[model samples]
Target: MVFARYLTPAAECGGLGLQCLGVGWQQVSRIQFDGRVIDCYGLMMIVRGTGWFVWGDLPRQRVPVQAPALFVVFPGVYHAYQPDAGGWSERWVLFNGPSAHTHEVLGTLDRDAPVMVLQGPLDGMERVFESLFEAADSSSPHRDVVTSSLVHRLLAELLAVKATTDVARVVRHFDEQATGPLSIGEHARRLGMDTPTLRREMFRATGTTPKDYILRTRLSMAQRLLLTTDRTVAEIARCVGYSDAAYFTRLFSRRVGQAPSHFRKVGRPRGRDG
Candidate 1:
């Protein structure tokens, strides 16, 4: 299956200094981009299968990659990549702006070494890509602004996963399981550590307690559902791990400073149904 969306930024989107030119995902027997130096940045995530990549001029290096790997396509760089005979599935985003250069300067994206083996539970990263694809839809309101924010978020999440530390694993675990029943004690035990050690590690890495992080993660999902889906508040509440609708409302109101219904009304695209 192959699907892609290309976006043209509105005038107002330029001030943000970031624009997502396109978003796409494909399942293919083979694919290649070679011979021409492109003028925009591309982020590609290999969802399945193995591949070989060759980049640079004259003295290029050929790299073998497995599934769940990520690679960057720098503007004007000589690069080419293709899956093995078995093929692979990939999700990619095309973007360009001053912000991309800033990330390069900050060491968030290294042009010299463009690919990294992604580690830990990838569910969270996949969700971000899915959200980016959805937000780039032409029918979605504020396409440019939303896609730009999602791109930034994608980078941050990528960095966290690449850290490859115990805390990073813990965070990925929470990210994947936040909508289900969870307990700090159970998680710590699973990690072969005491609750205090887990707590300390989480605090040092994220500056937030595990409990609070879970709460924030759940609420973030709740907000996304509220804006993008037609599900009722009760359903969304349950979907995000709150069984009691009234209690969920109370917590959401306290933390988010607005009722879910009100937030949806203000945030949902015009003319969109329930």
Candidate 2:
């Protein structure tokens, strides 16, 4: 049997945030291929088969990649992956853009390490991938917005699989909380600590207090949404948890060095880079 689907994102999308360069599925039982270095990232998830993962000059590692496992290939990295006699079923997404560093900064992806054994079902990535496919296919008025949100969610989901740590936990909590509200004491209580203790520990670890950390997180998310979505300033302000659009606009302008509306249209201001 043969099954595969692919999509190339729109030009406006490439001009904005992380663009979904491509996506597809390969379900052949027997397979092998040598891939040369290129300027993008590719992820392959083994649905139901085993494979030998080979890299340049490295000893051929017999990777019996069980179902629901993912093998990642990053830009400028030469590699090869060949399924065993049993072959393998797989789905994948190829992506690149300025915002491609999300995974790296989050510490969830590594060039040296190319394999990721997933803990849950394999259809999740495919489902999100197909959402991207459909968005790119339809050329939705919100194509760039939809694609960016979907891709970001996809990467965040994959990153969630990595075991949590103090830093990761802190960052994750800050992200979730920063999206729609501001609550230090409440959040700290949920983390099982008093506000002062939480602030002290977070400061020791990240050089920033929980409040500052959450502010930076909110600003960063706002910047991303500004670049990506077609939403209005009031809408975005509320979405990021600010009921007062004027206040959100002023804060974003001061922190980002550009008004949210201007940033969305002109891309980071010239010579006013922050």
Candidate 3:
């Protein structure tokens, strides 16, 4: 058990809005935990070996899993986890902070379903935790605030990566069609998915609808043309698959905040000040 503690000084007055109670790494060669409900929110990431997370009421299932995964212990949740006899290595953070509740609100952490299996290698996340620990250990003023900020940043990145596996194929297909002319339904068919399913999945992965994504791609092409070529707006519009120059210019002006001709002159989209 390699652990470091951060004890708040009484003279420091009220606590930092958020605080890291402890940070550590442990090689679990022989450890058995019956389970305990704790007050602080915890996030543990497995660096090696396999394990089982046993939790919940009624059904009480034991989820057999391996490394490169993270599990959270929401405050007041009864959770027990242990490594297989082969053993495991773990990195963890025990924190009590308002940001922890923000994690729950963002659906990044759930009290009922507390496990998230990482899709790939965790070297990047390992470094993040190390930096977080270092920040907490430093004696700099407002280091507590810094640690809390790092915690929220880590949670945001984790949520961004969650469920990214399913979108790999969609992303591949999207890249292939980066300059093509295809309707949302046609693009959906290219990926062997119905329009609605693709729409939902794309939105989940990218936070934009299929139609909006294609439009953005098209607009990017138009921006490139305006920057690099002497082509007329009508010619550039046709190259990006727009039939009418007027409609394309209107749409471009709406999204880019400048008339196409003006953008071509200014080398950038104009703002309200412009």
Each model's total of backbone clashes = 0, 1, 0
The top-ranked prediction according to lDDT is: 1
Which structure among the candidates has the greatest TM-score?
1
TM-score, each model? 0.58, 0.52, 0.57
User: Model 1 over residues 79-140: C-alpha lDDT tens digits?
Assistant: 88989989999999998888888888655576766776676678778999999877876586
Q: Where is model 1 more than 4 Å wrong at Cα?
A: 31-33, 165-274
By lDDT: ranked, best first: 1, 3, 2
For candidate 1, the TM-score is 0.58
RMSD of 3: 11.3
Instruction: Give the C-alpha miss distance for residue 146 in model 3, angstroms.
Output: 2.3
10 residues in a row with least lDDT, candidate 2: 160-169
lDDT of 1: 0.81
- Residue pairs in collision within model 1: none
* Model 3, span 38-95: residue lDDT tens: 8888888887899888776757756765877778887776788888889988888877
Indicate whether candidate 2 or candidate 3 has the larger lDDT. 3
